[model samples]
Target: MRYLSLSLVVVVLVATIGLGWVFDFVYQQYSDPKQSPSEDKIEYAEILTKKMAVALSSSNNANAFITAWQANDGYSLQIDSINSLALPAPLLSDLRLGKSLNIESDSDLNIHYAIPNSSDVLILQIPYTIEDNKKFINRYWVTSLFYLLLIVLFLLWAKPLISRLINLRETAKAFGKGELSQRITVGKVSYISDLESEFNHMAQRIEDLVSDVKLLSTAVSHDLRTPLARIRMGLDTLSEEEEPAQRRVYEKRINAHIDDMVELVETLLAYARLDQSMLAIEKTSIDLFALTEKIIKNKQKERPAEHDKSILLEADASLAHCFAVGDNTYLKMLVNNLLLNAIQHSKTTVLVKICCRPNSLVLVVEDDGDGIPEDIKVDLFKPFVRSKANKNKGHGVGLAICKRIVQWHQGSITVEKSEQLKGAKFIVNLPSVEN
Candidate 1:
């Protein structure tokens, strides 16, 4: 904060100093009596000198000539010599240069006028009256006051911005020390508000990535232990069994455990990779209704006929022609995972519904089963999080992968208790084709 304030002060000071120099230079060149006559002064002096020379051509009285000149002018004049006046070197140089008029100043400015080849020079003493002094002081004082006001206004404008930057620096320090949740709040009128917003977004992404990595570590340790232990136990059983049939059974059990571990590892890898830069997403226009219908058909075929009677997969007619922007393959995977999740826990039926609004399409997958527990619903989208009811069914990366895919599509997915279906409702919103 202090550094910013000091920098602003320095800038204001430099600006004021530079402007002051410019104003002083202009005044000295055009308005100061000590300098050469301006254009107006030159014309006035030439006209006056011509009249005086003509008047003196027929008269020899210097006093009468000086009186006549003084009668029409505002200044006092006298005929003096070049050597007696102790004129400055510059005026003496001007006299030697054969110039028509010579000007010189000491404590006060004066003009020396002499006709060519005349030994006596006419001296006009320019006065410094109280009014002139007042005007000079007022001009400089007003200019200084104006510059001071500008500096004050600049400081006022910079104060809030500097304070915000200082706060942001402290927040960054805290974030570096592991306060991943630290974020800057943006004010509407802030000069760096856009920068602050981008920083907040970057910070949030970093926080989420760090959290996902930690959760993946913990989940791998906890979920893999059971399947690995079972695989070991199954191998031990096969080693002890002499009967071929029992050995075959133990071998199959071991293979199933191996498959579970493999599937878990693959799912975790996919969920982790979904956030990476290398993941290619080819977005095209995908009909939401047709996609939902296709997923329902595939899931129905995968379900056994006996279970079909209890768990019916139905796609609402509203899902028929609604279109959205998404990668078709990833969209299918998203729908499949969501529908499978619904079917696995549903009691009698699972419903896939797609509704189209003006700008967006909503995909809903819900079932008539026990609703999600209130405690776990909030974290359902997080990696390795699952409802207590279906904890043993699969690795918890399915919904997390769905969430990552949804985010990639520039959309959002949320879970809530389905009021109509009386089950866990998953609502996914995607940009409509017309959007």
Candidate 2:
């Protein structure tokens, strides 16, 4: 629409300006006063001056001049007051001195002479009898054609844009009425192609979010049943148990179920918070190398001795302060989740590598354990997607949350088979910044 409007404006300016140029050229050629008096006009001035002198010889005024040439058709004459003429003072002086004057006329092809008859000025004019043989374009016809063409062209330009806008409005209405799949078909060079593309993207994002919410609700309802069943069973057994220790055992089991439910609810709330706050990320410069190293060391120290695994970190010496632009809090969460996930599944060593590219920093984490199986790999990053290895062990939202955090920072996270560690390798790439 913007492009079309600009084109219309340019057309208006060019057409009007071009027409003005043509109009001015024609007027200058056929209408402006001629610059030079012709030789015929000089000869007529001489003849008419003498003729007027003889005609007005008696009365030396206009009444004698009028009576002498009233029926004359060889030329035309008119009397005018000296004060009414715009002739210069010198020209008037010459006229009074009995001299005839020749001058140009406003019509490019006409010339006339002025003669003083006594105290009066007699204007001698020969009618211009040249008729135009060819039909010439006048302003009325040209202006009508300009308006007609402009209207037709404007309608042509408006039709496509109006149709697109109508389609857009209807699609928006459908989407507003809960048609989650509604989307506009994009055109190659539409005036509002960018707007269409953005709308499509927004629709897709909204659909995905709605679908995730439904899935989350279903998963929550189904997942809570097991713990609730266990809690119920524990309570029933506690009422039947006679010994204090047996009663205490049942209490412990019931408390554990309640704790699991609390944890699940807390995880869902946290995810909700993260989703809502995505656009409000508090951006700051962060030293990714240092941040990742600190997370790795802290998790390594926090792990129990019995489930020990050698956690390793590797990077070039120059990457001690590799900088990136992002919210530090979420970046820490992303790094922590990846590391915890690595430690949970690793059979031996959990290896991490940090490297810098021309415009980004890459962090790779690989675990020396069974890699992601082929069956569950497709939706491994979606919320609550559990692998057989970790089935019923933990809610499968860690990877999904990590993925969201990376995406919120305008980065990417991917997992593949590890060549070096013979397990899952997670790669995260974030835009780098100078320190």
Candidate 3:
């Protein structure tokens, strides 16, 4: 059964149980002898018997006995019962002895009659127990069963509505998880018509955003590459005898422009690949400290002076055996960017520390140079963002790319003040595979 059907069944069962309790209460009340008129009738018969006996003993006539009996308190003489002469024996005995009796009547008719040599009248109240219980069944159970069946039928007929609701929920979940093509298709069910409309609108908006990003990336890559290619061609065509100072200036300018173009293209590509569906990660256990050492050695070869004077690798030798689950290529790229950024900013000493914490591997790179300004630190990881202090050094894609790479690895990177050194510290925390 569907959820709605189950809910309705529960409601019906509860109502049925409630009705049963109410019937039980009413049955108990109706069955009580004190609430019936039989007890009153028996008491009245007994009083009439005492009055009649006194009148007869006084040597009065039958008419005088009847008058005395009629004069008793709370006693009414009915013509139908007296004429019928159908009084029960038990009631007659009570009337003659001036004692109380209890009786029950089932039918509408009752019997009242006088005894021999006495004006006392007996009242016969027939048993009505079976009829009373029958009334309860007819009055309550029949109507209750009818409504319960109707509720069950309604719930069964609503199966299509419940199914549509379940489909809509699943579609919403898929769309939320980056499936832009997911749509809710509920045919002819007007109840969920509004939700279906809203879902379509949301899906359309998501598709539009994805399309726009793809188009923008393609156009920007094509448009920007043409100028960079032309600049490189012009530099290649420069004459050998050109003024040395002017040629050097031109070379620097051309190289700077090319660097700028490359940085812009890389940043755009990284941003476009932020969604997990766009990239596949092949994870393997890699020694994190060894990876860091390899990246540091490679950077030393690329920028020998910067590495020799400034960079320092302080890692526990034991941590060299520690491993993490990540794509090694992306992990290398992430470490390279952070180390390069530190080398560019650090003045004298750049410390790279790797250690293992419970459930996580921590890498801290601190530079003993002027730290980043507080105002610009918040925007450090944003694409195409740069600080005035480092504008001449290189493009600011390094940190943004680092951030994306760390996120792809299911890790985190943050900047803070280094306690042991007077500079900025970049901390990278990755899940520890060893544990």
Instruction: Give the number of the best model, judged by lDDT.
Output: 2
Rate residue 297 of model 2 by lDDT: 74
Displacement of the residue 156 alpha carbon in candidate 2, Å: 8.1
* Per-model TM-score versus the true fold: 0.73, 0.69, 0.47
Best by TM-score: 1
Model 1, range 233-261, lDDT digits (tens) per residue?
Answer: 88888889999998988988899999889
Q: Considering lDDT, which of the candidate structures 2 and 3 is the better prediction for this target?
A: 2
* Candidate 2 Cα errors over 4 Å, as ranges: 1-174, 177-197, 316-322
Question: Tens digits of per-residue lDDT for model 3 on 286-316?
Answer: 8877888888878888886564556778876
Tell me the TM-score of model 2. 0.69
Model 2 RMSD vs true structure = 7.6
- Number of clashes in every candidate structure? 1, 0, 5
For candidate 2, give the lDDT of residue 357. 80
TM-score of candidate 3 versus the correct structure, residues matched by position: 0.47
- Candidate 2 clash figure, as a count: 0
lDDT (10s digit) by residue, model 2, range 118-190? 4556666554333221113344555566677667766776687789899999999999999999999987657
CA lDDT of every candidate: 0.74, 0.77, 0.67
